[model samples]
Target: MHAALTFLLLFLMAGTIVPVNRHFRQTPGGIPVFVVSNGVHTDVVVPLREPQTGTDWLEQLQQPQLTARFGSYGYVGFGWGSEQFYLASYGGNFPKPGTVLRALLPGPTLMHVDFYQQAPRPGKRVVALQISRAQYQQLTQLIRASFRPDSTGATVLRNAAGYTPEDFFFRGRGRYHALRTCNDWTNATLRKAGLRAALKAPLAGSVLHQVRRSRFHAAAQ
Candidate 1:
């Protein structure tokens, strides 16, 4: 089963006063950019301020992994805090008419996956995750789908109506088109489908999990 990893907005403004550098990374294009890390070096470049750039990036993930990760679909989003990310896992079987798809993310860390029968529009499926195999699959698919034949070539998948680089990755800092920010896509989509907030408020004490604890702790001192 291949799963597509997606995210939902927990914070209306991503309320982190942290330095922009801490949240952003440099791209091969020599551009300083914000990104959504998949717990791997490969990141989804987010053009929070640039529509042309953002759209180009979003289009790239549409081809393969975005559709193949997990089983049929998966999603990624913030967990209980800013430090925790999540994903949901599932198989690739479309249900009978009106039979909505459902999946779960493992662990008791206040995280889970919610499957939407129609997303971005009716008859479309969208997966939202806070922590689970879906995140893993989404990240893996992003990595797998990366690598254009050349710099001029588009990222493997960039034309699917459902794949929005800005939304799939991280929301940009400003509004673009109808989306006030990439986060809006997440919030609107999940909220439209009536999803409860998947993330608790950002932890004041810096909630770092094992993989990030050492690095996060080191920076605190």
Candidate 2:
């Protein structure tokens, strides 16, 4: 089991919808952002660069080794969670007994950032949204703020390699606990960015359902 995929926690899975900003028109011209999920986990994926603004994230994202290995990546997916679960999520195994128990308590957090080669497609496990330039900046700012600062007051990317060369872990802000889960962080990011998100999303199912329902509603309109 990959952690919480099978856990029987009694957290709230129901969530309410927050309408997208009235000023934030859902037009094709808006930047395309994607929320991807792996049933148990969710990631907020964003563009690597905005040609119009000439905003290059490589400098701020710590120039991941992926650039050296494969030139450059098109998109980046940011995830925050317990360091124990993240480190133990190597190969196919999830956290063991001790790891799981410790994760229940307030522990250090890490950002599991992954670089994508192509644009993420919106499917059953992916919800795509078109947001304004301002919204995109806001979303990115929240994500950036989650990174823990190093001694030099900069976001520190761990020297340790990731599951793949394309992804790496960074110290994260805030503590990971039973109440503020990975999915909860994801939900908070969206809500902070002034997007349509659930009222409560401590579980992946809760966040996924809210996003899917919002997408359906938008499509039906």
Best by TM-score: 2
Q: What TM-score would each prediction reach against the true structure?
A: 0.19, 0.84
Q: Per-residue alpha-carbon lDDT of model 1 for 85-175, expressed as tens digits?
A: 2122112233433221111222111111122222222111222122223332333333323233335554322222222232232211222
Model 2: lDDT equals 0.77
List, residue by residue over 1-221, the lDDT tens digit for candidate 2: 64565343322532433333323335456788888998998899888776755656676765545446544668888999998889998876877999988998999999988888888988888988877778788888898899998777777877458888677899999999987899989988987887767776876766776666543235435
lDDT of 1: 0.25
